[model samples]
Target: MGFCSYKSFVILFCLIFTPLTKADLLSATLNYHQGSYSEAKREFLQLAHLGNADAIYNVAVMYLHGQGVEKNKAQAFAWFSLAADFGLLDARDTAMLIAEQTDNKQPLDDAYNALLKQLSFQWYDQQLRPELNASPALHLSPERRYTVEPKYPEHAYKNGIEGWVWLEFDIDKSGAVTDITLIDSYPEKTFDKAIINAVRRWQYQGNNQTLPYYNRSLLYHFTTYKGKQYEQSFKSQQREYNEKISDLIDAAEQGNALVQYYIANWLSSNDYNATRLLKYHWQQANANGELLLRSAVNGYANSQYRIGANMLRGKYGKVDREKGLNWILLAAQSGFASAQYRLGRELLNSQYVDYAPNKALKWLRAAAEQGLFSAKRDIALLLFDLKKPMQQVSTALNEALAGDNEHPQLLLLKAKIHAATGNSNDARKLSNSALKEAQTRNWDQSSIRHFIATLP
Candidate 1:
C-alpha cells in the first residue's frame, strides 16, 4: 500500500481504538481542514462515537470519500443521521443524498428528528409551561397565554367532516401569529384549507409578562357525534398521529399479514409519516387489512416486500433470520422486484445462517437483471468490496438511475467513482449535482457539503 493509504489506515485504527479528548478532537479537525484526511477521520470518528454530532457528520464525510476508510454509503448514512440527531445542522443537511437511494423516510426523518429532539422547541409543551401565580388574585386577571379555540361551522362538521387538523404556529413578541404550518389534517384538502385560513386570522393574548413567547401546537378535533353534534376541542393532535401511527405499528407488530407486509415499506418511504399525500394513502389501503384479516392475506407486492424486510431485520418482533429469509425468498420467488432485491440483501448479510457469496451474487444478479436500482447499487458495492471488475460496477450505477434521472445515491456513487479514477472535475460536478438534488428535496445538505469539501 502507498504511504497515504497506510497512514490513512493508521488514523482510522487510532480513531476506532482511542477515546477522543476535546483538545485532540480540535487538533484532528484542524488537521482535516489542513488536508490531513486520515488524521481528521480518526479524530472525527472518536468524537462521533462520543456523541458529537459534528464529528459524526465529519466521519460520514470520510466514509463518503474513502479518505481514511473504505467508502460505504450505508455507514456514511448511519453516521450522518446520528450526527444530525445530535443537533448538528450540517448532518441534517447531508442526509438528502442517501435519501435518494431508496424511498425510505427512515434516514430522512431520523436525521431531522435527531436535531429536532435536541431543541428546546421540540418539547415546547413540556418545557415551556404557563406559570401560575401563587395566589387566587392571579385567577382574577385576564387570560394571558394564547388560547386556541376552533370555530367549527355548526352544520359543516356535523354533516360529514371527521378527523383532526393540527396547526403549528409561531407566537410573535407582539402576540401576533406568523409562520403557520399545518402539521396534520384530514386527507381532504378543502378541510385543511378552511382550518388554515381561519387560524391565520385568529390572535391570542400573550401569557403573562415574564413569558417572552414561543411557538404553540394546536389541534382542532372536528368530530361529529350522533347526527348533528360538532365539537371542536383545543388539544394537541400530536398524540393523534402518534396514536394512529402507533395502532398501525401495533397491528404490524401483531404479525397481521397485511400490516406486517406494508409497515416496513411505509416506514421506509418518504411519506411514511402519514403525510397528506397519495403515497401515504396507498399505505392506508394496505393498513386497512387491520379490519379484515382474510383480506390482508392477499395484499400488494410492496406490502409483502416490506413484511419480509422487517422480518429479516427482526424489527417487528424476534430475530428470526431463518423465518425472515424464508418469507423474503417466497416474496422474491413470487416475482416481486422489491422482494427480490431484499432477498438478495438478506443472503448477502446472512453470516450466521450461512456464508454463501456465490449464492448472494446469484440473487443480486437476478434482482439487478430485473432493473432493481437498489440491487444494482448493492451489487456495485459488493463488487467493489471484492476488488474485482470495478469499472463495470461504476457503469452499472448510471444504469441503476437510468430513468429516475439524477438520484442522489447514484450521483454520489458517480462522484466517488469519478474521484477514484482521478477525474476531479467530474467528481466535483457529480457531488454538486447530488447537493442540488438534496437541497431541492430538503432531505439534508451536510453530507453533500462534506463530500464537496473533500473534492480536489
Candidate 2:
C-alpha cells in the first residue's frame, strides 16, 4: 500500500515535501536520539544542501541546544530563516521567536550577519567552563588514589615539543600497572616513555571486585616558560584560535565577568604563543589570577572554585594554605557541585585535622546529590578508602552503579568494592561485566584477566 512503507505518507501532504530525502531525515533523527549528534548534524547538513525543510529545522535545533556544535542562537535563527524561506511553517515560527529574542549588535553577531546580512544582536551567557586549569581533564578516567604527574622530559621541554600519546594498560589485582602498550604516539616517541613510566608508578587500591583492566588517552605537552615547567595546552598565543577561544578573548576584553573568568585560565596556559617577545606563562599567570579575582569578586561560584583549586594546586610561587581552603569553603557554601566534591576529596585526603572521613563523605554526598557524575563514584571510593563495613561498602557501590550501570570506571570500582568486602562471587560477576564492556568498547585488556585471577 506504499512506495517506502507507512513512512511515505508522513512526508506527503506534510508542510515540507520530501522527494528523496525522507530516509535521510529519519536517519538523522535516529542518530540525534542515539547521542550521535555529530553524525546527525552531518546528515542534516546534507539534507539542508538539497533544501529539505525538516533537515534544516533539525540543524537549527542542534545549534540551539549546543548538542553537536557550540551553541549559537544567531546561527540557529539564521538556519531557521532559511527553512522559513523554503516554506516550513515550524521553522517560520521558530525564526520569528528567536529573532525577537536576539539583537545583532555584538561582535559574535558577525557570523549571523554574514549569513543574513545586517542582523543585530545583544550579549548572551558569557561564562566559560573553569578554564583556570588545563583544558578539562580526561572526560572519563578512574577516580585517582595516587596520580603521578608525567615527568617533563628535559630533552623535549628544551625543544618546546608537544604532542599526545594514546595508551592502553591494565592494573593488576594489587593496583600496580602491568601491561602498557602505546596505542599511538604523536611526533613518534616524543613523550611516550614519560607517560608510560608515570602511569606504571601510579597506584590504585584494587579490591577483589575491581576490574583489573583499564584504559586511558593521555596528552603530554613539554613546555617551559622562563625556565619553569608548564604542563598545560595553552602554550602560545599564536596558535590557531578556534571560534570559541576567539570569542572568549573578545568578550573578556569587553569586560564580561564570565569571559574574564575564562580568560584568566587561558592566560595561565603555557600554550599561548610564547614565540612573542612577551612570553605568557610566567607573565600571564598573575594576570590570570587578577582576572579570576575580578570574576570571583562578582560572586561567580565557579570562579571562586577555580581560584581555590589553582591556589591549592600552587599557581605562582607561594601557596596560602588557609586562603585556598577558604576559597573552596566559599564555593562549597554557595552550593557548587564541583567545589563540594573537591572539598570532600580534600578532607578525605587531608593528613592534618584528624582525617575527617565522615565529613568528607557528607561533602561528597552533597556533590553527588547535585548530580555531579563523578561524585557518586567518588563516594563509593571513599567508603572503600575508609575501610568501612562490608555492608556499607556494598551499599555505596550499589548506589554508584545504579546511576551509571555501564560507566567503565564505575563498573570496575564496583568490582573492587566487592573484592575488598570479601564477596568473591559478587566480585567475579562484576569483573566479568567490566571486561565485557571493555572488550565491546574496543579496550585492550590482555594483561588484566591474569591479574583478576590472582586476586584474593
Candidate 3:
C-alpha cells in the first residue's frame, strides 16, 4: 500500500482502539510499531507541541535510538528533560541515566537548561488546577542518611551576590531524591543549579513500613563572608549614609512628602537595615508606618497606595477595610494606574467591598488606557460579563492577546466569542487548542471541556 493509504489505515485502526480525542496518539504509536519511523516522528512532534507527555517521551526515544533522526544524545537528553518536567517518570529516569553515562556532562546539562529556558514562556500561560485534598500530609519526617552542602558559585561569590533558593523534591522508594523543582529564589537562577545539584546527591533513609514522601521543601541560603576589608568598606558606606540621613530626617519632619516616603522605605527594608546600615540613627518601632501615614496625609499618591495595600492585607497590623479602601481611592483619584487596577479588581470581585461592575469597568478602563495588559484582560472579562457588544469584547481581547497570546484563559474566552458569532468549527478548534495548552500546565480542563461539548 502507498504511504498515505497506509497512514489512513493506521488512523482508522487507532479510532477503533482509542477515543476520538486520543486517536492521533494511538495512530502515531501504531506508525512507530509498523517501522514507519519518519511518519511516527512527524506525528509525535505535532502532538508534542500540544503538550502530550507520551508523544514527548516517544520523541526522546526516537532521538536516543536514531530511529528517524540522527543519533544526538544531547538532543535526546533535552527532550527527556522536558518530558520529565511534564511529569513522566520514565523520561525522568532516562534523563538521569543518560546524565550518568555521559562523559563531561556539562554539554548535556547545558542542552537541558537551554531547552527549559526556551520553553519557559509557556510556564505562565495557564492558571494551575486546584488539587483535590486526597492525600493527608506526611506525619513522619524522613531521616537523612547523607547530606551535601552546595558549594557557592565562584562567579556569584566574587561578585558579592548573596541569595537563597527554595526547592521542592520527592524522595523515591530507594531513598534518592527525584523530581527536584526550584520553587523560588532571590537573585533568581543564580543559586538554582547549585541547590538542585546538591539535593540530587542527598540520600534519605528508606523504610519498608512507610510510603515515600513527596513535596519535601528545603531552603538554602547563600551568604558571603566579605572579609575584614569588605567589612571596613561596608562600615564606611554606613558612616556616609549616617551623615546624610540627619538632613533627610529634617526634611521629612519639615513635611517633605517624598523624603518621608523615602525614609519610610529605607526603614522598612530588612535588607537595608540589618545587613547594610547602622540602624541606631534612624530606628524606631513602627516608624515606617508612621512616616508612610505622614506622607499619605501630605498627598503623596505612592505612599497612599502603599499604605492602602498594606492595610488591606494586614501587612503591618490588622486589616481595616474601610480605611484601606479610602486610601486606595485617594491614590486612584490621583491617577495611579496600579491603584486604579487594584480598586477595579476589588470592586469587581467584591473583595472587602460591594460588587459594582460599572465602577469596576470604569477604573479598569482607566488602567488599560495606561497600557497594563492585565487591566486590559480584566476589562474584556468585565465587558463580557456585562453582556456588552461583541465588537467591544473582541477589541479588548485582541489587544490583550497581542500582549500574551499564550494565556489559556484569554484564548478560551476568544473561543467563546467565536461560538457566539456562529463559528462552531473555529470555536471548537480554538477551545481544543486552549485545552491542550492548559493540560500542558496540568491545569483543570473540566470547565473548558464542558464548554467545548456545549458548542455545536
Candidate 4:
C-alpha cells in the first residue's frame, strides 16, 4: 500500500508540473549541452515559469554557473527545493547535494531577499520585448550595408528659411535605397531644390521586402552659418570671409585647446590681429596639452609635438629646449611623421649623440616608408650625403625624382649635387626648370635661385 501511494504521487507530480512544450524544452536542452549558458538560462527560465520540472532543474544549473544570473549556491538550492516540494526524485537528490554544500537547513539568508527582487523586476522585464521590437535592425540581415550621409543641405542655408519637408524612403530586399525624398530640409524653392537634388541621389536597402519599396521616413537638419534673409548683395563677400571665423572664435573663446592650436597656426600666417590671437590660442593649447599629458602620458603625439615646437620657436613664450626635446622624442616614437622629421633634423644638427647620422637616417627612413613625399626627398638627400662617388648620388637622386621630378626641394638638391661635381650644363638645366615650376606653384624660390646663381 505504501509503494502504491508513492508511485501514484510521483505520477501526479509529473502531470501537474511538466507543462513545457517539447520545442521550448528541446531548445533549452540543446543550449545547455552546447555550453551556451546564458541562452540556456533564458530558455530554462521561460519553461520554469510554465512549471516545467526539467526546466526548473536546468535553471538551477544556470544559477550554479552564474550564467545570466548571479552565482548563488543558495538560489540554486532554493530552485531545486521548489521542484523537490512536488516529490521530484531528481530534484530531491540535487537539493540535498546543494544543501550539504551550503551547510544549511535552508538556503542562505540572502537568497530569499534576492528572489523577492527578481519577482519585483518581472514586470520590468515583460515590458522590454516591445521596446526591443522598435529596434528590429538587430535581427535583420547582417550582410546588408547602410551608407550614412549627414543630413546637411547640399547648398548652404540662409536665414528666414521656414517649412518642414518630409522625406520618405524604402530599403529594398537587395539592401539598396529607393523612394527617397527631401523631407523638410528647407522652406524656399531654391533651398528645397538643393535638398531634393541630394535626396534623389541617395540610396538604401530595405529590410521587410526582398527589394526595398518606399516605406520609411528620415529627417535632415541644415543650419545656417551666416547670411540673414535680407542681406544686401554688397555684404556677400564679407559673410563668406567672416563666416570662417565663427567656429574658430567659439572654440577659442570656449578654451578648446585643439581648436585653439589650429586657430593659432592660421593666425600666425594671416596678419589680422595675428600676433594677439596667435599668443592667446597658443597659451590655451599649451595648458590643454599639459592636462592631457597627465592622463595619457606621452599620448596625443601631435599635440605634444605642436606645443613643443611652439616652445622651441619661442613665439610669444620662453624657450625650453629640454622639455621640447623630451616631447619631440615622445611624438617621434609614436610615429608622428612631422615630429619624426623634426626630431631627426634637430638631433642630427646638434651632433651630440654617438650615432647621430644613423639615428637621423633611421627616422627619415621610417617617415619615408609611410609615403610622405617630403620624407622621401629627405632620405634621398641623406643618401647623397653618405654615398661615395658621383654615380651613387646620381642613382639616389634619380630614385627620388621618379615620382615627383618637378618638386622644388629635390630639384634644388639635384642642382647642388651637379654643380658640386662640375656638371655645369646639367646643373643649369635642372635649376632653371625648378625655378619656373616653383614660381608657378607659388613655392619659395629663393633657394632655387641661389643654386642656379652658383651653377657657374
Candidate 5:
C-alpha cells in the first residue's frame, strides 16, 4: 500500500482500536463549522459507520473539499452514494450532479456500486450484527436494537414524490409494538401505510414490573431532491389563497362539501387569526356552526360528525339532542369510526336518549372492529358493568390494553377485575399504576388513591 498521510493514519488507528464515543451530529457539525475539519471528519466517519445518513453526507462533503483528507472525487462520490441509499435526497442529487459533470464517469459509477455493496444488509449482518447482539441496552427507550426503514412507495419514487409522516405508537409489556396511529402526514396518506407497517415490526425492552409505555412518537421523512419543489408548490398555493380568501368562500358557497368542511373546521379552532378567511369571519356569530351545518347537509361525513358532536355539547347554540343524534347516525351509517364511537357513548349515557344497551353495544363494536382503541375500552367497561362473563370482559380489556396499555381508566378497570377475581396482589399493583398515571396527567387522583387504599 502507498504511504498515507498522518491524518489518515490516525483515522485508521482509531477505527481499528479506539472505542467510539457517543458524539451527536450537532456537535460534529459544530466542529466542522468551527474549522476543526480533522476532528469533524473523524467524528463523521464514526457516526457514518453506525449508519447515520447526515454524518455520511457530511463525510462526503469533507472528502470533496479536502477538509481533512486529500480531495478525491471518487471517495466523495462513494460516500454520497452511501448517504443516498440511506434516503438523503440532497446526497442523491449531489452524486448525480457530480456524475454528470465528471468526464470519466465509469470509475465513479464503479466506486458508487462498490460502496453500496459494502453498506448493504449483508454487510450489516456480517459486521454490525454481532456488536448489536452483545449490547442489551440498545433495546431500551431512545434506542432500538433493530429497525426496518420504511420502503419508498414505488409510485412516489417514480414520480419523485416526497413528504413526511408523524406517528404515535405504544410498546406493550411484551416489548411488542402496537397502537400505531398516524398523528399527521403531509401529502396525506402517501407514506402512512409504509411507516405504520415498518413500525409494527419494532421491538423494545420489556419489563413486567413496570407498566407498558404509551404515546411514543416518531416523524419520518421521505424525500428526493430534499422536497424543495413540493414545498415551493405548497407555499405558492398558500400565497394564492392568502391573496384571495374570496375564492375559498366562493368554493364553499358552491356546495363543495370538502371546502365547506375545511372552512368550518378552521373557524371552530382557537387559531382564528391563522388564515385570512378565518380572520375575516372571526367576528361573525356562529359562522363555524353555519358552515358545518351546510357541509353536513352537503353530505360530508366528517362535518356531519363534528356538527353533531358540537350540538350535543351545546357548542353550536343549544343541546339539540334530537338533531345531534340524527346527524351522528348519518355519519355512522356512512362508516365513520369516530361517529360510531361517539354515537355508542351517547346512546349509553345521554339523558336525552333512553338508555339502549343493545344499540350502544352494536355501535361500540362497529368502532372497535375498525381499530378504535377508545371504542374497545368503552366496550370493556360496558361489558363489566353489565356483569358479563369474566372471560368476555377480560378479552375486551386485553384488546384495549394492547392498543393503550397506559390508559388510566383501563388500568383501573383491570384493577377492579383483579380484585373481583380475588387476585389482590395484582389488583394492588394495577391500582397503584393507575394512581401514578392519574397523578402524572394532573387528573383527579382522589378516586385512584381511595381505590388503592381499599386494596389489600
Candidate 6:
C-alpha cells in the first residue's frame, strides 16, 4: 500500500473514479487513497461480500496492521487465509506467519491448522463466474425479476456510433451481477459505460433460493438508423446491423486491426443466418468475409480470434476446423488473453482441441500471468493435477482462489493434497466441504464422493 509511486496513485485514482468500473470498487479505493482508513475498511468489507480478492486482502491487512480497525491477529489470520485460499500471494505469506505464530503458542501446528481450516472453508465466487454451468440438473441463471435498462449514450447517438459490444458477466448466488468484463467493443469505448451500468442493475430470482452463480454473456447493440435511435438494447440478431457499414471499408484498408474486425463484421453481418441453425455458404463469394480473412492474414489477433471463432461456428462460411484452430493458435500465440485462455481451456478440458495437460498449463499460465482471473483459477487446478512442485501448487491455488474460492476442481485437488501430506483431519474436512459445495453448486459429485470414500 505504501510503496506506490505518484504515477501509480494517479492511475489508482483513475481506476477508482473511472465510470466504467464498479462503483463499490471505486468508492473503496477512493476511501483507501484519501486516508479514510475506517471508511475504506467498510467499503472493502462490502466488496469482500461480493468475493473480490483485493477487497478481502485489504480487509485482512487492516486487521493485521490495525489500520482503521482494532488489531486482531486471529481475525487477520482468518481473513488472510480466506484471501490466500483465493490466491492472494500477500495474504498467503502473512497467513503463514500468523499461522506459525499461533501454533507456537499452542505447542503444536495449531496456527497452521487454523490456516488449513480457513482454506477448507467455502470461498464464494461472488459472481466472477459460475462454478456450475447451467444444465438440466444444475438449475442456475434464475429468471430475471428486475432488470434496469441501460441508457443509450447521447454522445454516441449523436455521432452515429452504432454497433455492439460483447459483455460477459456472472449472476451471483444471490442473483446479483458481480463480475463483468468487456470482451469486445465496436467503435472502441463509445458505449462501454452505458452497457455496463445497465447490466449491473439487473436482479434475478436465483432458483427461489441461494443457488450457485450463473455465467452469461450478451451483445449490447447500440443502433441508429434513418436518423432515429433506440435506448440501447440486447439482440441475438447478428445479421441486423448498424448503418455505419459503408464507412468501415476505408478503415479496414488503413490496416487498423480493430477497424478491420469491425469492417469484416459489417460485411459479414447479413450473410449468415445462424439464428435459425441454418447457413448458406455456397451461394456467393462475399467481400465481407473476405475482408475478415484478409485481416486475419494481416496478423491482427482480434481478427484472428473472431475469424477463428466464426469459422468454428460455420457462420460466415463452411466450418473450417483446421483453419479455425490455426487462427485460434495464431491469436493465442500473439498473446491475446482471451485466445490464450480459450486455447488453454480447450487443452485443459479436452474441448474441440486434444487434451494436452502440459501445453494447457503453459498457455493458461500465460493468460493468468496477463491478469485473466479465470485463467489463474484454471491454472491452479491444472497445476495441482499435474503434481507439479508444492510451492507452485500453493501459489497457483492461492491465486485461483482469489476469483473462485469454492471452485470444485480446486477443492478436490486440495483435498487430495492434504491426504497425501498425511493431514487426515484436514483431508476429511476439505473433502466434506468439497462435496457439500459441489452438491450445492449442482455439480456432478460422484467423483468427489468416490475420492472421499478412499481417504482414511
TM-score of each: 0.35, 0.40, 0.50, 0.37, 0.46, 0.47
- Cα lDDT of model 6 by residue, 1-456, tens digit: 321122210111111112322224445666777889988887677556534566777888888888898987877877877777767888889877887777444422354366444333253432111211122232224677887877878865554445667776666555666556677876568778988998877776656454444335466656555122322421322233221222233334433334445545544444222111111221234554555555554445776676665555455334555655666787897788877877776566444557788888888889888888878877777777777887888788888777778866677878888887898888888888888986666455766889988987
Residue 114: error of model 1 in Å? 56
Q: Considering TM-score, which of the candidate structures 4 and 6 is the better prediction for this target? A: 6
| Candidate 1 vs 5: which has more TM-score | 5
Clashes of 2: 22
lDDT of all predictions? 0.51, 0.58, 0.67, 0.51, 0.67, 0.60
Residue 12 CA error for candidate 2 (Å)? 43
Residue lDDT tens for model 2, 282-396: 2553576667765564345666776666555445334444556666777797787777877886776565673688888899899888866556777877777678886887687
Against the true structure, whose TM-score is highest? 3
User: lDDT tens digits, residues 1-456, model 5?
Assistant: 221122110111111122213344555776899999888888777556545567788989998999988998988998998888767899989989888889998889788778776574345333322221121222224335458888988887666555567576666555556556664564568889999889877766645433255546565766554234445644545554343455556555544556565566555444222233355744565566666665564456776676565555455444557766777887798787878877887788644546798899999999999998868988999999999999999999999999878877789999999999999999999989997876664444665778888886
lDDT of 4 by residue, 1-456 (tens): 322132111111121122323334555676778887777777667545433455666777777778778887888777766555434788778877876766555545466455544432243223111111121122222133434444544433222222223354444344444334332222334345545555544544444533434224433434332223333631543443233344445534432333343333333332222223334534543443333332112133554565455445443234445556666676687677767766666655643443487788788777666655555666777777776577766776676687687866688778778788888998888888888976665444766877676666
Provide the global lDDT of candidate 1 against the true structure.
0.51
Q: Per-residue lDDT of 16-129 in model 3, one digit per residue for the tens?
A: 222222224556776899999999899777656544566778889998999989988998999998888877888889999999999989889888788776553254123111
Give the TM-score comparing model 2 with the true structure, all chains together: 0.40
Provide the lDDT at 79 for model 5. 91
Record all residue pairs in model 6 with backbone atoms less than 3 Å apart, i.e. clashing: 86-401, 86-402, 87-398, 87-399
Comparing 1 and 3 on TM-score, the stronger one = 3
Instruction: Name the regions of candidate 3 deviating beyond 4 angstroms.
Output: 1-229, 236-238, 273-278, 350-353, 440-446
Q: After superposition, how far is residue 25 of candidate 2 from its true place, in Å?
A: 48
Q: 452, model 3: CA deviation in Å?
A: 2.5
Error of 5 at 94 (Å): 67
Error of 6 at 71 (Å): 77
Worst 10-residue lDDT window, candidate 5: 7-16
The parts of candidate 6 lying over 4 Å away from their true place are 1-162, 167-182, 187-220, 224-248, 266-288, 316-319, 349-355, 406-408, 428-456
